[model samples]
Target: MGSVTTKKHQNGLDYVEVSTDLCQARIFLQGAQIDQFTPTGKAPLLWVSAADDYQVGNGIRGGIPVCWPWFGMSGNGGFPQHGFARTRLWSLDSINMHDEIVDLIFSLKLTEQDRQYWPHDTEVKVLFTLSDTLSVSIVNKNNANYPVSLTQALHTYLPINDIHQLSATGFDGSKYIEFGEGPYQQPNDKVNFDKETDRVYTDLSPVQHLHTPTGIIEVSRENSQSAVLWNPWIEKSTRLSRFKADDYLTMVCLEAANVLDDKVTLSPGETHTLTTHIRWV
Candidate 1:
């Protein structure tokens, strides 16, 4: 059996911490963002910045940051990148324990101020199922009379023993665009990082394997066709907030996303869900 409790960080943000026979995890209510997950006898499966301030209204540097309504820049300019959902506080709806598995549900309802940034009537909820494996799902329901379109991602930061010793598989033959550049087809069986890489891949397999020196981590997604693989390497890492210059060598982000043509569109009374399951294999 497991127990769930709410704890406050020194910076005044509240989060839910879970302890079970199988694993332990932490999820901040501010973004419903998970910052830590570890199996009983394994190293952490997620990576977080050592420099993260854990302050209010700021997204934490790692784990899974839920990007909703929009991803990256909103194109309208002056609006916060990756939308406002990650900055707003969410409600802890429920916590249920099923033997060794613990389920935590966090929800966010669009506020009047949220409408100024994203003019839509939608309800959002994120479910974190923790066991020996971790599964995260984000559900969006359109409550308005008109249709709405949005792009989102579960920005997941994964730990690595070494960047040079890592290779990611499952993207071969997929179409990808690098930094808005060419829509190139992946020609290699595996992708190894040697430089800064920002790629959005579409039409890829739902399962990806991250081969690290220590072991393999399997990342599988549902209701997503687009995924983003990113690593700042050296230069860009220096300029990122709450991140160290050399942090890129130890962490990489393989996000399950809906971007470009994979964006979601929902009519009135419609609902959409995006999910990602991760575990050591």
Candidate 2:
């Protein structure tokens, strides 16, 4: 019913290949990043940039980039932005094939080298359940005696027919922190990209729908308290590495995150899982 394979991807990165009657997917061992997923009888749902070179140790412009330990710049002046998970290679722990679905477990442990940034004993893993729909479960377990506080995000880039015409419905009356700064606004209409849009929203809405000319796409999550709506527009889009300046017109990111006031605190022996589910209609 399903199969798993391995292949050498861009710049010598290794990725696990999954194939089933219901869908096809590719998960890079580096950062456990998923670059592609297409369910049967549906249009391609995920988005990747045309300028992506897939260079080793560099985060691809699109796909699900797991930002862990910290989401944005931690202001340390020494740590890498979006943590080191996206640059480090993850170990594939297990893979199981069922009647019509496939499950793959990938693990990453905090190493001595990683301690210099935010020293904490931790274990991170993501379970990818791929079938007609895609579900990614990111689990963080704290091993340190003291409580560890951190922020993480599943940077999910979604494909749409057009960015200008796309409408995201769900946060009709919610407030958002624009560009990580203050003066959060409560939009009167659904999300529509007029220009550079980067906002972090709280209130923990459970479901969001991205409406395109073709159809409406559903994004659902569990155990997530924050969502990031982003489209680099012109200025930041041109500055982005491995991304075309005009690529934002075809893609938008609605990420599941726990940041700022929603930052997660995990005590010793405690674990937290943030999950995101995507489907197209």
Candidate 3:
């Protein structure tokens, strides 16, 4: 059996803490983000920055940040990077416990200020299932009469013993576009981190395996054809907010995304759900 309780973090953010027979987790109301998840006897499957201040307006540097409405820069200089969803507070709508599993639903309130960035009648919510494995789903419903476009990602930061010793699979034949680089094909079967890497992969396999020194992590996605693999490495880490310069050595992001050509355009009254499941194998 599991129990859910609310506690205020030292940073003044409110979060739901779950302790179950199978696992323990924390879900922050802000961003509806899961910053800590660890199966009862296993190592942590997620990572957070030690330098994060956990402020109200600033996005947390690690865990899972919901990048909604848009991903990355919106091209409009005035718009915030990676949209505004990660900075807004979400309401915990429901909590259901099934034996050792706990399901939490969080709904975001769209305000008049949000319409200035995206003018559409839309409803967004996130469902997190905590058990032996962690599963998350972001549901977007178009409430408008007209169509709406959306690009989003579950920006997941994974822990690693060392970035230099990590290798990932599931993008062998996928087409990837690096930041300010070509749409190149991944020639190698395994991806190794050495330098700064920022890649948006399309036509990718739904499942990916991260071989870390600690163990293997299996990441699978549903209703998503694109993914982003990023690491600030050395130089960029120094400039990243709420992140330590050496943080890149122990963390890597393997985001399940809907970006580039995989972006979604929802018809009126349509709903789209993006889900990702992560587990230690």
Candidate 4:
């Protein structure tokens, strides 16, 4: 079994690239927690952003970045937006390679620094495995002797040439809370975004599909209840320096998430796992 290690280059830049026989995938990582995602291979299939190169235009945030106790600004979470998982560095515990596949496990131990945001003693492990298919597993171990509530998501930004011509299936009959003044409740299944939108959908099956003009993207999840679909669209895109207003036509954020609105509880010493597997045809 071998592991992924880092070496600094003479350019004074430290970047992490996947070294694997699985040429279909590449895990581009950075020491800076807030740095946007980069794709070297199959990842580029996940997203190609016209706005910024570092930001993952449309691929799942490839590793398990915990979204503890809350999903966005919804009050249930006491920390800042989207939790603290993204802005922190995770320690690579081990890496194992077998045949043509590479598996890397990353762990983050809750410390006083994490307690400052939310008081909880937790051990989070993220396993990234690449083979013919790309998969991620998030394991949460609660060290406390009581129950803990958390909300989370695997935020995937999927690549697209034209968002207008694509449609998402699997959420059709599910319920969703619109993130706007209306805050309307609606069914899932097939959604077409005509205006600015942000909302969390509750009640999901194990699988969802994204159909584009080129091909179809199938997303399968385990122990996840929500799916998020996002595109900056027109007006919102104009406001973003990273994204041009019309650039929204090329990318979309399709996330498999468990929002605070629908919380998951784990008893003391209990462990919970969240998983998602992606494939396209």
For model 3 the TM-score comes to 0.98
lDDT of 1 by residue, 204-226 (tens): 89999999999999999999999
The regions of model 4 sitting more than 4 angstroms off are 1-15, 19-21, 28-43, 48-66, 74-78, 180-188
What RMSD does each model have against the real structure?
0.9, 1.3, 0.8, 4.4
Cα lDDT, all candidates: 0.92, 0.88, 0.94, 0.62
Pairs in steric clash, model 4: 58-157, 58-158, 59-157, 60-156, 171-188, 171-189, 172-188, 172-189
| TM-score winner, 1 or 2 | 1
TM-score per candidate: 0.98, 0.96, 0.98, 0.81
Tell me the tens digit of each residue's lDDT in model 4 across 1-281. 32355644343334344545444343433312212222224444466445553433222232323454456764644557666665555676676778857777777666677777778777777777666566777778888888888877766667767887888777755776666443345654677766765766777677878788877778787888876767778878788765666777877776767664556788989998887777665
Indicate the residue-level lDDT of 4 in model 4.
54
Error of 2 at 264 (Å): 0.7
**Model 2, span 177-213: residue lDDT tens:** 8855864656664777789998888875878999998
Clashes of 3: 0
Candidate number of the best lDDT: 3
Better of 1 and 4 by lDDT: 1
Residue range 1-281, candidate 3, lDDT tens digits: 57899999898999999999999999999999999999999999999999998988877899999999899999987998899999999999999999789999999988889989988899999999999999999899999999999899999999988999999998878989998687898897789998999999999999999999989999999999999999999999999988999999999999999999999899999999999999999
Residue 74 local lDDT, model 3: 91
For model 1, the stretches where C-alpha displacement exceeds 4 angstroms are: none
